[model samples]
Target: MQFTIIKYEIIVVSFVALLIFLLIGIAYLTLLERKFMASIQRRRGPNVVGIFGLLQPIADGVKLIVKETILPSHSNTLVYVLAPIFTFFCSLVLWLVLPFGQGHALYDFPLGLLYILAISSLSIYGIIFSGWSSNSKYAFLGGLRSAAQMISYELSMGLVLLCVILVSGSFHLGSIIESQVYSFHSVTLFPIWIIFIVCILAETNRAPFDLPEAEAELVAGYNVEYSSLAFALFFLGEYANILFMSALSTILFLGGYLPIIELIPLPGILWFTVKCLLHALIFIWVRATFPRFRYDQLMKLGWKYLLPLSLSFLLVESSILIIINPY
Candidate 1:
């Protein structure tokens, strides 16, 4: 009984630590995205808050907290109150299965990958509820778009993940990383690695796949009616989901916590962070460089292009393994 209590306490403490890290990362990611986008557009971004806008996120947080939470006259009061909370909680829960470094994961569940996919799929509900409960046309349209887009892309993303499971032969994230680690004489498997990165970007709703929040059509999508701290929660959840997806990509494809070159002797966590940041940077870069697709184009690309490609990759990988073993 005493040991169980200690274990529970440890788990709680670890979850709290992870929450802090995620919140900090989300704040900095907003700053970093603005900074990067500013440089690309030949302008300064957020320079006044602190040294080169280092404290800008904190200032923004304070402002949001102090602002009024205005409830719309026609809104469903109960769901209006609950939508952002649900969205924030869903995003936060994803970190439980994410492995940060060697022996650093919260739980080593055998079905970790499937568990993450399930949680992510469920997060769309929060967006739907927020939009519908707001009782505004813009909000309703935004919510409908988000639900359709997420469902469409999620299918392709799942197919891509199915390919990874085929190649690695396990749903455990740590095992997937171990499969990617280089041995003495064999050549590294590069094909699976490439597919994993592409899938991660799509799964996270990064551009060229950000149809859910396309400003041209939905005017900020499902959270259109949110303001002040309520809006902040949605913003935080979106960026946190980005970070979580990037971290998951690092773990599954780029060899989580493993050094890229293997010659350098850096710590595992350092490698993991660097890899995640690079992935995040790529996401931002795509947003800056590419234009959003038409809704039909986006749906076509996922269903027609990515799905079949992922399935073929799985088939080819299976054939290679059979020929190599022949028994």
Candidate 2:
């Protein structure tokens, strides 16, 4: 009983530490985006807060917390308040099964990949509920768009994961990582990697695929009615999901927690983080480089193009797997 109590206490402490680390990561990711986009546009970024705007995220957090939270009189107050909380909660919980390195994950669930997919699907509900509860047409339309967009792209995403699982023969994230020891899937399955990247961009509501939150059409999308800390929660959740997807991409393709050179003495966790950061930087770069896709075009690309491509790859992967390991 004493040992069990100590284990539970350790789990709680580790979770709290991870929560702080993740929140810090999300905050700096926003700063990184702003700085990166500024350089791309040849404009000065947030240089007023701290050295090179290091403290900008902190300032923004304080401002949001202290500002008045405006509640829409006609909105369903309970759901209105709950939506962003739920969204942020879902985003944070995804880290539970993420393996930072060999023997380094918080909880090494055998079905970690499936858990990630399941939790990602649940993230859509927060958006839908926020839009419906807001009692606004624009927000409602935005929510509907997000629902359709996520659902459509998720099919392709799932197919892509199926291909990976077929190749690795295990749903466990760590086992999947270990399978890439000899050769990274990014090199072998380059086309699938490309499709996965596109799917994740849409999944995280990033630019080009950000049709649901299109400023011109949906105003501010499903979170249009939110302000102050409510708005901040949505902001944090969006970035958190982006980072999560980036980390997932690293695990899937870049050889999670693996060093590029066998001679290098770097820690696996550091290598994993470096790979994830590169992917995250790619996210920001794509935002700077591409124009937003029109809603119809986005849907057509996902359903018409990506879905078929992913399905084909999945079928090929499965056939090859069966041939190689026939019982």
The residue pairs found clashing in candidate 2 are none
- Pairs of residues at least 3 apart in sequence or in different chains that clash in candidate 1: none
Task: Please give the distance, in angstroms, between residue 155's alpha carbon in candidate 2 and its true position after superposition.
Answer: 0.2
Q: Write down the lDDT of every candidate, Cα atoms only.
A: 0.81, 0.93
Q: How does each model score on TM-score? A: 0.94, 0.98
lDDT at 160, model 1: 64
**lDDT tens digits by residue: candidate 2, 1-327:** 999999888878888999999999988988999999999999999999999899999999999999899999999999999999999999999999999989888888999989999999999999999999999999999999999999999999999998888888899999999999999989989999999999999999999899888899889899999999999999999999999999999999988998888999999999999999999999999999999998889989998999999999998888887898887
Error of 1 at 86 (Å): 1.0
Q: Candidate 2, overall lDDT? A: 0.93
Give the clash count for each candidate.
Answer: 0, 0
Candidate 1 lDDT over 106-129, as tens digits, reads 887889989999999999888889
The lowest-lDDT stretch of 10 consecutive residues in candidate 1 is 183-192
